[model samples]
Target: MNTFQLSCFLAVAEYLNFAQAAKQLHVTHPAVSQQIQSLEKELNVKLFQRTTRSVKLTDEGKVFLWDAKQIVAISDRAKKRFGGVAGGNIETLSIGCYNFPCMFLLADTLETLRTIRPELHPRLQEIPFQHIYRMLEEGDLDAVVGFKESANVKINALYKEVAKVPMVCICSGSHSLAGQKELRLCDIKEERFVLFVPPKGMLSIAQTQGQLMGERPPSEFYFCESAEAITVLVKAGYGISVLPDFLVPDTPLISRIPLKDVDQVSFGIYYKSLQGNPALKAFIQCAKENLTALDI
Candidate 1:
C-alpha cells in the first residue's frame, strides 16, 4: 500500500470512526473509505470490522497498526531531513503548547532556550490538545508541551513527564459545597457542571471527568471552549468545574477543594525522537532544567 492509504488507515484506526478520521485528515468520508478499500484489496485481508453503529479493528488490523505507524514515522523523518538540506538547513525550532501549559510553563521554557541556545531561533505556537500530535507528525511542529494523558494516541514520539499536578474541584464561594473540606463525585453530580470541550474529533474534558467518576455521567453539563472560561463561569455562579491545580486562579470568589478519587495530571514535553535537529535537542534540555528549578 502507498503512504496515502497507510495514513488513512492510521487515522481511521486511531479514531475508530470513518467520519472522525476524515474530519481530522481534512478529507471526505468517501475518500477515506475508498483508500481503506483499496488498501484492504491490495493486502488481501480485512483490516476492520464494520457495522452500521460501530467500527472495530480485526486481529490482523491490530497487528498491522504498529508497522503502519513505523512506516509513516520513518517516511516523515526522511522528508524532514531531505527538506532541510534542500532548503539550506533548518534554522527555527517550532514548538507547540496547549493553553494551560502555555499559560504556566511556556515563558520559563522560552527564557531558558534564549539563555542556553541563543543562536537557534525558536517559534512557539499555541495549539489545542488534540492537534499537537498530528502537527508534530506532519513536521509542522518539532516539540510540544501539554498534559501527558492527552497524548494517549499511539504515535512515534518521546514523552518526558516533567511534573505531576493534581486536579481540584472549584466552585463559587457562596455555593453550598464550597465550605465542605472534602468533595466527592456524587456530591457534585447534581450541580451545574462547566466542562471544557476541545475541537471536533478530540477527547473532551467531560469524557475525562466521566471516566474519573467511574463512568457516572454528570447530571447537568455546560460545555465551554477553555479552562479560563470555565473559571470565569464558576466565579460568576454559573457552574462548578474541575481544573488542573496550576490553572486554578487565586481568586477570593472561588474555592478549590480536593476530589475523592482522581489521578494527578502529568504535564510534560513531547517530541519525535527521530528528529535530529540541534535546536530541538537544546530546547528540550533547557525545558527540563527550568521545570526542575520551578519544582513543577
Candidate 2:
C-alpha cells in the first residue's frame, strides 16, 4: 500500500532470509517481518514460504517484485521530473548488468565520460540477466548490458553487432578434455559439464547448444545459478564449463578450448523502451568507440 511496505517486501524477497533482508534494509529483523506481514495483509495473500532455516518466495511474491518496483520508480521519477539539474550536468546513470564479462563496454563508456566530465558517477548494480529489464523499468537502472532475449521486451545496441567476449569450454589444464585445440559439441558428449542455469529460469545458452547439436547429447550435467560456483566446479575438476576466455588466461590451472562448431556468445546493451537519458547516451557513445575491439 505504501513505499515502505513495498521496499520491505522486495528486500525480503531478494535475500529470502529475514536477517539478511534486515541487514540490507538497515532495519531490525522484526521490523522487516512486520512490514512484509503488513503487505501480505494488504494484498490478502502469502508472499513467502518460511521455515526455521530457510525462506523462499511464494508464487505471488515473485510477480509482485516487478510490478511494485515499477510503481515505486514511476512515483520517484514523478517527484524529480526535472532530474534536480539546473541546466545540464552529467549527474548520474544507474546501470544494472548480468554477471557476464560484458563490463568492458560499460568501462569504456564511463572512462570516456570521465575525460569530458569528471563529475559523472554512474551507480552500478551487478545482477542476473533477467533482472536487468525489470530493474530499468522500475527506475533502479537507466540501462543494462547482457545477453538479449525477446519476450515483449525491447532491446537495442549502440553498435551494429552484439558486443561479445570469446567464451570457451574450460577444463583443468591437464584434464583429459584439455588436449584438444578445439572441440565440437560431440567432443564432450559423455563427460560431466558444469553448467550455469538461472535459479528460477532456463539455461538459455546451454540449451541453444543442445538444440544446435541436432540431438541433445547426453552429458553428466551439474547446474548452479552462480557463475563463481560453476568456475569452482571447473577448478575442482568436477566438470568443464563455458566461461569468458578473459577469466582463464591468468589461471595456470585452467585450460579453455573452443566449442568446435558453436559460435561466440552474443552480448549487448539493453534497456527499456524510453526516451534517451544524457548519461546513457554518453555511455553508449563511448561503448560504440570500442565496438570493433569487442569482436562483435
Q: Which of the numbered candidates is closest to the native, going by highest lDDT?
A: 1
lDDT of 2 by residue, 54-87 (tens): 9998899887989889988887887686667654
Give the TM-scores of the predictions, in the order they appear: 0.58, 0.58
> Against the correct fold, how does model 2 do in TM-score?
0.58
Off by over 4 Å in 1: 1-91, 100-104, 150-152, 179-182, 198-208, 211-219, 292-296
Candidate 1 local accuracy as lDDT?
0.77
Count steric clashes of candidate 2.
1
lDDT of 2 at 178: 81
Misplaced by over 4 Å in model 2 are 1-90, 128-130, 150-162, 198-204, 209-219, 244-250, 273-276, 294-296
RMSD in angstroms, all models? 19.8, 17.1
Q: How far is candidate 2 from the true structure (C-alpha RMSD, Å)?
A: 17.1
